[model samples]
Target chain A: MRKPPYPTVLKPYGQALLDLAKEREEIVCLSGDLTRQCEIDLFRDALPERFINVGMAEANMMGIAGAMARQGLIPFVHTFGVFATRRPFDQIVNAIAYPSLPVRIVGFMPGVSSPGGPSHQAIEDVAIMRALPNMTVIDVADAVEIRKVVPQIVDLPGPVYLRLKRGEIPVIFDDDHEFFLDRAQVLESGEDVAVIANGMMLSSALLAAEALRGAGISVAVVNAPVVKPFDTRTVEAVARGVRAVVTAENHTIVGGLGTAVAETLAEAGLGRPLRRVGLKDTFAEGAKTAPHLFKKYGLSTQDIIDAAWNALGRTDSAPTAAPTPAETGEYAPV
Target chain B: MPSSTTTSEVSISRFADTIRLRAVMMVAPQGFGYLGQALSSAEIFAGLYTHAYRPGHDRLVCSPGHYIIGAYAAGVEIGLLPEEALLTYGQDDSDLEAIGTETSPAVDLTCGSLSQGLSGGVGLSLADRIKGEAGRRVFVLASDGELEEGQTWEAAMFAAHQGLGALTVLLDANDSQVDGPVSEITTVEPIAGKWEAFGWHAVDVDGHDPEQLVRALDETGSDPRPSIIIARTSTRQGLACLPEDADGHFIKLPPDLAEAAVQELESRLA
Candidate 1:
């Protein structure tokens, strides 16, 4: 299959973050020995004084970030999503969250962005960060989105967690596309079904919408980057008009976009039959291959098509079958 | 809002006495608490809160938050917090929460988890430094037990590498932790060496000696390196009548034994 046309005018999020660092001297960057891995090398090269490498210690990096925040510097702590969530959760809660410190936690290689096996894949980062109070969670859909969102996060009052995709991120939005921390963008509008997606799954959802349209099933694709203060109004509005909701994400189905959409629908009394197309309540196991795992966990375009059809009540004619637990049971919940 | 006070008269012996008296008072209300750790850390807390630290409405992040009573007593004595609040220690509906409160004016960072305060302190200190505010120091009191947390070392390494001269870490090496002695659980020996290796200017001192602590703090004044004061102290430093084997982390004194401990403290104070 031919890849979708890449956004030519898109700028990398890492470059945007480095630009912010130049403008704001107080905006310090900290990494846990994953500078290149997390794409913080630009910040390191440009603002050497402001960049700190804590050397593979995520917990300590978190604590130091909190301490730096306390001292009046805006510290942007970087690490893999898994390490940031699991290693220093206590530090994040107590030092950063409880104190309401202006510590920007940048989790690199989120979801299946890393090919370094399950250990590096941050499949459940959203679930862990979302549970904490006074936390702002943002999932950047592409480099353009991340570049645009980096400056806005600086002005935010409390703790901010930015989940970034490593390597070259595909652009899903144009420069003219309007974005807000609390608003979800309607990329493609339709009435038959609504697909709420974020991160890597967003592009897939858009592709699925196009495929569904070719099959005469109209679908609305909403890009929900900010997951904490989720665009509940947009969600409710979208849910009100749709026959069924298909929430997709690169994270686990439990706490990521799927659960967020499910809860929003359930709360608004707009409970439609919902299908969450993401990693099941499980971790990414087996070899460190992305394509194999993406196909296995039903996160690819085919999975979204099947899920969209299932939500549209056309499961009998859906092109793909629902993945049984036995076929993909090796990926247990982390 | 500033009061003129001097550390000249407050010697190590006097500070140790105050710690013992305060620990006794804390146990007077609750028959059993972390008296061993509190008493052991008395001289160090007294030195920092009274002399070395420039206390104001500014922050002090206490990680190893179990030693809260010791901090409270020091705050009370130094007029940073209300003395009456100490009476309500561990009571319901008290502003002086058994655990620290973020909303409370006295408490800076609400700490219960060990090895988390340095991060908060770093945040506060970084903010102050960026604003070009001088003389404001972020003091973090960490327990020996908290050394087990990799984050502490992370903060240590960051602070030193960043040359956060305004940040001072006081590691209370009272030799006791929950469950058993620290050595039995995780040997954090050569702690000063570890800090030195992390690029910090580490200094070891007799924790019961306030004079030594003050001198150590003075020496680190405006130094480019992140300063760490490793205070070697005993869990049971000042009080008698408490059993020698009593775990300072959590003291369990029967009613009669509690009364006797209080009486012993009272006699010492008298």
Candidate 2:
């Protein structure tokens, strides 16, 4: 059993941002004592004057960023995804969102990616950030998308809540692949199943599609990185002729990719059999590795394959033996 | 627009009295507004706008946004806002809200929530330092009750750590809050000592006295830390005619009593 290549996206993100900071003095960095953990140390080391370590106070970091924005300086804040969305929600709404400041809040360890358990996992970040009026919610699918999106986010006018992949992550997209805001990337197209996914789950979706092809079940993998201001147009188009639909994410099914896709389909009157693969209503327990958490939370490639079969109403026998982990009584719908 | 009245202490005192009268007129008709908090803050607004601050350039953040009625009254007194706009206090499509928010250009920083404005003031002052924008100071006026919010302490520490000498804070210690006396609400006493321990240049002053407030705003020692003035005040300081039992935190002034209070303020100005 060999592991796939997992390249660190944080290093390249830091390198790309450091280059941007050299050209733009208004680009200031803020962190809540996770400078090294989130790989903002690259900006800190290269340009100490522009980097601000606001200790562990996430709310104050948001306030400081809002104030900096008020004074015509663009501030980028980094922290864990949970703290980024939950800890400073009121401040982010009042100071950042209501005023529509250009503060880039980069939240790493989105959803079940953090093995630090429920406290560190941000399964509801996308749901909460999308609820904010002026907030642009972006979930990066891979290392290549992260590199391309950083500059695009800098050019964006209002506040953004960016879901990030820290440490080593697999490269799923090509180096020259195009990136657009409020747009979903159509990775592979098929007629049998429209498999929409975002964040780290997109890679798993691609794997599941590849594996399903061998079983004569074609699955369309649509990488939906931008959750808020969701690409419903592209989603409907991709899902138009597909026999069934499935959505995948590392976040909870409540307000993540699954809900967005369901809403799009429901509104379009395209009532196809739909299945969602992600964390249930239950909190994740601490695990040693992402693969372990993925298995426990029912986000592995096998879960996606099972969901695809279930969506197609083929429950007699499947590629994998175990039932859709969602049906095993581990998680209740939220 | 420059104030038509003289900038002397006596003139500012009379102007502050007129502002208090205007605040009562704006809020009293609404049947419910922050009349007491607004009256208590009139002198502080007068002291800053007339003596300590340059409104067009220097920034003033109202952390305790209920006090905005008083700020708007002072703006009208100083000819910053048209006098006829006073009737539009809580009406729809008006700049004025029942609670001050991001609706108006009068407030440099919009904060209806407590304890958040100081952080904005810190950012504005820090920006001035980083951008080399000299002669620009940021003043934040907050309630003593807002000190209970953790973000206030965080902003306090950051201001001291960054050496934000250009930032000044007026902690309106009106003792009263919506939940009753702040002492009973959360025990935010020993407020000046806390600021001093946080490495700020702190001072205690009679909040109602314009002389003391102006002096605190103007004086800064060799210390490069920020400044906080603990202003001990009564929530209903200007309306001596009102009963002591009348709750000032948020009140609907009786029509007759509201008129009588305004008459007393008008007589003092006369």
Candidate 3:
């Protein structure tokens, strides 16, 4: 994993997809009038015949992708997180999941990452997607995972709901770090508090783990990219060694990464004092910058720190707020 | 391209009767099912399976789950679906759901979710076009009530936008829904004009007439624009022995009524 003030990569997802599509003929990219925003513009320009601009009709777009998959083409459908999941959920369930097709629903700008407010924020995407039987819900942490994820989930048996961050993505993990659909990246192995995270909040968890270590509290950090089909054995092993657990996500705590961790631990006969750091079951407002919403929604590095402190029964003042991790040219990771 | 397994000897009229007979048998065992769908769409399905659909080449998506019963019957009338499978219709541990699910055979994809099938058909058409498979066509069997759904118009707009010439919609305009007359529930009339406005080649026809249905089916994939055959039908189109109080939407079949209905359907061959 990379340190703070990490380098950022622009359009990593779009570029990786384009490169993969060149070799994989079955990779068909779909856009819902947000091609540039979701970063599938590269795919459109590179492979005109394979890329489809399905206008603003998300429901039809989902069905179309499902049908395309039915004919042996792996469709990577793109749109904002909300439009991709909430708008066309039934179509995804009926046309894709129920049929167990190999269509990948690429939802960008998950949670409060979208500056478009509640209407555009997909705070509940993971929860809804995780409920579906055959769906593989994923939330990658950085550009490294983004690049590695595209090639991995191409033919993953059934439909996949991939939650991605739009625009310039941060480089959290270095080139040597590997991403797997069925494994969690154990970034640190300290035993006091276990911090589990996915999507944009993963950077926050990593940063908070650093600060917690400075405060002399040992913390175990795990990056849970694939929320559904969660790496339960890894999580159980990590959580079992820790006194308390903290789950941070760029989504609501209700049914997202936090809930996944909670359910996994509870079912395994392991009960730890768990604190969830996320949206707290509330809608977010429109913002000028993504960090404004992230900070206001209690999804910053400090939030993870506080949650870990609370879980560990450490009542002292939360660690000092750290500098905003990414600069203007980069996308917000927390 | 035709299904290699197709037995083309069966006449369209006989095929339609076969659909009706098989559907009645499937629903009668349960004492209740979407019998109205089979009655209304038997002719429409019979015409398509015999004239337009090529099992291995062409794609047929049944959009309305309830409408699938009729298509299932048509599948049995031919040798495509196993003969004895109809006996387990609507029973537990049976894949033959009363309202066809994605697991059901014969149709490609699902009809379980109303108003989504047309969009799927458009996608299939686009895939065939992308693969340069010019001979492959896609057909969607839909119900009139689905016109009320916003997704239907959304799919319609996408199909037209793509200029999916190989796509066709066999719209069953039975004008009856579970909530009574569809006209009372929603104004779906001027259906042809709506399709035309959506940039499709719309053809209105007597759904039960074999000749009209066959002609409409023949016009599919003839141009850059998609086509929709608005088939006007009645839920009680063919049977002569239904009692005066029989509800066409969902008939409750008593032993006596089922026997009478079966005898009437069988005697029609005479």
Candidate 4:
């Protein structure tokens, strides 16, 4: 309800990248004419010689990154999520991921974060990049996590597709929060229900968990940042003990965090009743703000709360939180 | 015809002829390969390996993936690959597959996907420039069909924009694609002009002439801008001695016709 304290989450990412570049000369920054949008201008400004602006050509940027990686320089490429993943999928898969090159493809405006709508949203990046043999996929929850995760992947080998939130994001984690690659962060622990979320969706999940706790529901929130190597061990342990499960994300429910959790639980034979909250097999139309789009697509904290209650078999019977906008009928169903 | 051919030029021409013959012979057993494309690109490879590309120092990238036979034959000539391994091409458990990738023993980078090698070459050249490996040039052997890909133009733009003088692209303008002639499928004509417009020092040469190709490739590097040698060639340049059926873009070389083609190349080399 209040204004987010952070003006832009991507500044930390840009600062982190610049810091990394300062630490290692092998670190080179590249952009697809999104230096300002992706907040890579800081890196560009600091290390002008190492920064390469490849213009609007995503595929060429990827190919050049692959070539740069081959030359033993670590190239961190930034673009719109869709352009970074879908437009240049072949170049990433063949030239980068297939060869296990260490080209970090940082995709901003992931999922429904892009107000530019379907063309710009990278809803399927996680699914596609997850399918790659040697790709490491990570969706950071907040700016604090971004500052920690961005620098860690520099030393790691092989290709990495990092989904990021760009401008004016809510701050979640504290300053001392540390990040580990391929590890899940358990934000809150409870016995009755487990809510697994990633990227900006974790903020909503935290809010939903707070409201659920006020209702004496005792909900657990797992920040599943490393989406690809899905942290099956942690997810399995959480799903095994929890009474019910709810997975939320800003991406399609088909292959994002929801699917990752569902697959992990199903493979582990946990048989816990699960609810997936995300874009249901469709595209997000252009909207004025991300929060309105979230409320429209049933991704707001209220949606997560409702899904949690439904997963617990309570339905709409017992609810103490404020009313959701989905009940208001202002956002017509697509 | 341009100048008096030296003994080394004659030897490099023989190497190219052997590459063409080996490509024909290797594809004959399988009955399927990019024989036409390989034949036209042989002299480019020979000119590069013999004149420009240093075995351990410089890097050569094959962007036209199906030209694996030419790469393997040239690899044999340069002692990077064994001649016995040529027989195992397109066969099971062989390092030399029908398409060349960075995984292939002799290949420095992968290229099954088109329009990627020039960018890769640019990366290598850029790395060379940064690492102070000044004389270590990066050579890319691209195809006419690959120019149809938008990434090729993007790479062309990037190479010139970076002023990659150590990068030289030998475009095998073999005039045909798998579908049809390159013009009919997609008009990449004004090809030299396109490269020049992209800030490359574009040079047009006869692709099949080892001497001219050697000269063109030799002269392509050391310019301030990225250089491109558009080697104008036929799709099936060397197999003209065979029946017309042997000249398709992707041909299944019948055993007897394949033999005849080899003999023609052998006699030419002799």
**lDDT (Cα, 0-100) at B78 in candidate 3:** 65
Among incorrect, acceptable, medium and high, the docking class of model 1 is: medium
Worst lDDT run of 10 residues, candidate 1 chain A, spans A325-334
lDDT of 2 by residue, A31-90 (tens): 899987788899999888888888988888888889899888989899999999998899
Clashing pairs in 4: A8-A168
Native contact fraction (fnat) of model 1: 0.82
Return the lDDT, model 4, position B200: 91
Clashes of each: 28, 0, 0, 1
Candidate lDDT values, in order: 0.77, 0.82, 0.87, 0.82
Off by over 4 Å in 3: A324-327, A330-334, B1-10
TM-score of 4: 0.94
The candidate 4 chain B region of ten consecutive residues with least summed lDDT is B239-248
How much of the true contact map at the interface does candidate 2 reproduce, as a fraction?
0.73
Candidate 1 vs candidate 2, lDDT winner: 2
Model 2 lDDT tens row, B7-118: 5767668767877888888977866688888777777888878887777899989888888887788888667788888899988988888677787545688688778898
Model 1 agreement with the true structure over B196-263: per-residue lDDT tens digits:
88898889998876667877878876677878899999887776676889886888766787677667
The docking category that best describes candidate 2 is medium
**Highest TM-score among the candidates is held by which one?**
3
DockQ-best of 2 and 4: 2
Best by DockQ: 3
